[model samples]
Target: MRLLFVFGFFVTYGAVLTATVNNPWPNFSGVIILWFMIYLITAPARRRREYWENRRALQEEYWRSSIRYQNRYRY
Candidate 1:
């Protein structure tokens, strides 16, 4: 999903850039660069989100296994 979004972003940016070749008033590079900078800045937060999600999944799996172990030992 993230890959798709990144790909879409570059594709859109390229398309807009190509479309603006005739006009020289509004420069899109700055806007695109700004957005790319924002994306780079927010990368850490995205990684943290992914980390937390993975940790939560692992914790859930551990609890499930613990519960099964306890149940198996209960005679």
Candidate 2:
């Protein structure tokens, strides 16, 4: 299912590029900039950053505690 979708997407994208790209370099560069701007506009900011930081901190603490527990048993 995922492979079929990927193939279909590439086929559509290639057709568009063929029809539109008179100057291939500039056209491809413009497409890349357009996608980058779309990503910047749609991506979340502060809340997502805080959530990820908190999750990372929790994971680090878990690993540290587990290592300490193992060392205690070894001695």
Candidate 3:
């Protein structure tokens, strides 16, 4: 299922991050910050994408229904 896939992805990422932290270049803090930033950027980007997609579908439906109604009343 989708949940399983998501869980697996996080587990894999966490393992890699653990390794990165263990042998971070110069320091461990930057790797942690980079991972946090990745989550921040990706979460909002996915949400914004879904919001726009729904708005586009609704606009298309409105236009289709308006055209149907206008055609029904034509002389």
Candidate 2 Cα outliers beyond 4 Å, as residue runs: 1-26, 45-50, 53-75
Q: All candidates' TM-scores?
A: 0.47, 0.36, 0.42
Off by over 4 Å in 3: 1-13, 17-38, 68-75
lDDT of 1: 0.74
- Residue-level error in angstroms, candidate 2, position 29: 1.7
Model 1 Cα lDDT, one tens digit per residue, 1-75 = 986797567756664664566785545675577567767987999899999999999998898779676698677
The 10 consecutive residues of candidate 1 with the worst lDDT sum are 18-27
Better of 1 and 2 by lDDT: 1
Clashes of each: 0, 0, 0
Model 2, residue 46: distance off in Å is 9.6
Give the Å shift of residue 52 in candidate 1.
0.9
Q: In terms of lDDT, which candidate is strongest?
A: 1
Better of 1 and 3 by lDDT: 1
Report clash pairs, candidate 1. Answer: none
| Candidate RMSDs in order | 5.6, 6.3, 7.0
